[model samples]
Target: MKNVIKTIGIWLYILGCLVVGSVFAQDVHFTQYTATPVYVNPAMSGFHGSNYRAGANFRTQWNAVSTGNTYRTFNMFADFALGKPTYYSNYAGIGINFYSDQAGDLNYSTNKVDLNVAYHFILDNKGTNSISAGIQSGFGMRSIDLTNAVFANQGGGFDPLGGETINRERYAMFDVGMGFLWSYSPNKDRSYYLGTAMHHLNQPELSQFTSIGVSDRMYAKFSVIGGMQVPVGERMHLQPSFIVNRQGPSTEINLSTLVSYSFNREPFDKNSIAFGMMYRGPLDAIALLTRVNLETLAIGFSYDVNISSLSSASRSNGGPEISLVYVGKPKNRGSERYCIPF
Candidate 1:
């Protein structure tokens, strides 16, 4: 009886997602928006403290809702800057991003790959302020497995598999996005930035079925992201960030604050510990985040505590995410005058 109840609840959750998808046509997202910089803004392609950057992220959600019925996502990116290393010189950036998401009992999945480019404009002689514009192009594929789907008319009762034909299992589409950003860094201990991005500008078709009356077009999404870094002391700093996203009829907002303490006085030494909290509004969840930095490598972890109406179904279990990042210069290269840790 417990198993049957869990199965029914899982189906209900899946049904809800499908209904919402059909109406709002929203996209999958990460709570840790800053961890996936390129996904948030193409202008962030190579906007780190180092000349090159690489990172990976993974998230899993709703494990307590039902066994074997959950959502998982994985993402990876790499980016680098072009031209000579000088604070007063302009440069270009290029990057690649890839991600995959799997959801529900049907094992529905989406895979995407994107290429991004950006140009940076130096706004001051000291290079303390700059602007950037970026563009991205991508392709994505969506698929679902229907072999285990249950139908109402199968065997004249509730059947796990029916005789109905499932003609389409996958679909592919192309997508594009653009962004603009402005950054200011007075010194190594303080920085601020704001950016906006628009995605799915083409609204490409997403339906696998070629039949009439099917209008499964991807909806356009817009985002606003901003953050600042403040030095609390010689070995401590504070960071506050926010992100707002809107797609079709749905919207989400996250606000966060973090504090980091460095073990060494040198800003570039990179030995530090950071911890923070975030709130997702409309009462979604409260997230706790922590990270450790070791020279050129950093590792981060976060967990969400659900606090919304869905907590009844989710059992307040929410989700957990992990991320790894690396930033470095070439073997013969030295550090630059301007650095942005994010």
Candidate 2:
């Protein structure tokens, strides 16, 4: 019975691929710049401070597009500095993240896990130039639940090479990645970061069909992020940021600017709020900004009002998005350590 179930599952996986290849629809992605971090690059694992962090994101695109095609993802990571050049200059840390995405009944879905480790090196006495190298390994599973999907055509009506209706099946696969990060800062507490990462270096086979097909040949991506605080007056400051992403034949860019203020309270508390717009070119079009925040705690949301030609049919409800982030450490709060850089 176990073997029979496995065989059925394999067949379902193949069917899912066929459906996916035929649909050729794009995913509903979020406009929030920080949610899809790891998908952008593995080096992002250590991009934050020497602390652990975690996040999740979900997108519903083309409301007019079938609900089955909506996209959802969840991610989490942890990093920390190690050694002691002066005080933990020999920085090192490890992180893990997971994500699952599905589109339409073509049943194209991926559940992946990543393990990463990185080390930071100081290249100058000025503390402005630093470099980090990181490696990542992980496995993924893809499958289709054909039993619940609504096929384009009734299966009973078809006959030819194979049966019209296939059940559900899943496959487990593995991949590896490596990345490099270069960072610099002209002043204290401000940074400019650049990184590159290559995913699917292992190029694992994903086909469960008799003919054996393959996944995307490979994914090479590059990213650049920079931010600085500008004095706006006595108690207010402005921060601007930009992020660019590329994968295989697709590319995207995100731009944002945030303004913040500081209080004269003890420990010098600080607060900030940011809003910016994004132009995803022909793919996605909209502007978004985040809500205000207190030190170590941040909450923000974004919405993408589609302006594409499809807008006419989508009721101007193209796609809406929301994101929430919390960063901070618990004081005298047990043995758990969090990466909440305020």
Candidate 3:
């Protein structure tokens, strides 16, 4: 019975791949997508409450299923409020980010660096409401180590050379994306925001094999993200956020909520804690997460519980992720007029 179940799980996975046919690499993804905002939307680049913010995230997935086939991702970013805004003045922000992802027996990897810029237009006095437009320009490299790849001809053994003529071992390309965001903040706190982005607008070619007559271009992706913080009590807030992404034949959606309690009474209290649950697309997994906001520092952790048919082989454990962020505070910077959040 156990073997039958395992075989069914494998078939389900193969069927999924067939149904999604050549969905191309949307693999640079995270269950805790909120932890790396800049990587998702350029408009979030410099949209924060403080003068500047920096953060990093790391993720490892599917370790229980295989010792050498787990997927790993790491990314870091820095965003800066370019100029000080007045009660109703428009301003701009800039940011840069780096991302790396790799997985499988072949050690296939994707790495990218991007520069983002955004211009904000204040919609009301006190910078309480605003809209912004942003652009991202980046360079990307996709590579793979074929040393451990086993082809059907190899009969399930490693082959340093698969008797195939490879066109290129790795390649680099230029990539572009754009985004827009709307924000509403009634008081001195995190703003409610809605944003949309279009990535891989240029559809950079990333194929590493010469099997096809033509190389493959990465599928463009569209994303919608929204978030808000609602005060539920004197010292606690309800933080709810969501993201939707579509690339070629693949689509993913995540909805999450966290309850945050401030240990300090300061307006921008850095001492706080938040815990919550999140759900992934079409019953992929359920995640539990917690975040700690300390003085000038924040850390977050999340665990994913898989529920798909693949869970049989994975023991329902999707994996774990962690994030670290430095939330900067400006001293005597003359009343910050811009928003903060990216």
Alpha-carbon RMSD of each model: 4.9, 6.7, 5.8
lDDT of each: 0.79, 0.54, 0.77
Top-TM-score candidate index: 1
Give one digit per residue, the lDDT tens place, for model 2 in 230-264.
55666655666566655545666666666555553
lDDT of 1 by residue, 1-342 (tens): 655754564456446545744643577777777788987899888777557889999999888775676889899999988765467777888889999988877777889999999988888888789999999999988888765555433433444421222234677879999999999999978888999999999998765443423356788999999998888998888989999988877788999888989998645338988899999977989999988889888888999999989899999978999998888855343436555556
Off by over 4 Å in 2: 1-30, 35-39, 67-69, 83-88, 148-168, 208-229, 261-270, 316-318, 328-342
Model 1: residue 65 alpha-carbon error in angstroms = 2.4
In candidate 1, list every pair of residues with a backbone clash.
Answer: none
Angstrom error at residue 153, model 1: 1.3
Worst 10-residue stretch by lDDT in candidate 1?
Answer: 159-168
Better of 1 and 2 by lDDT: 1
Q: How many residue pairs clash in each candidate?
A: 0, 4, 5
Model 3: residues with Cα > 4 Å off, grouped in runs: 1-24, 155-164, 210-212, 266-269, 331-333, 337-342
Instruction: Give per-residue lDDT, candidate 1, residue 258.
Output: 81
Give the clash count for model 1. 0
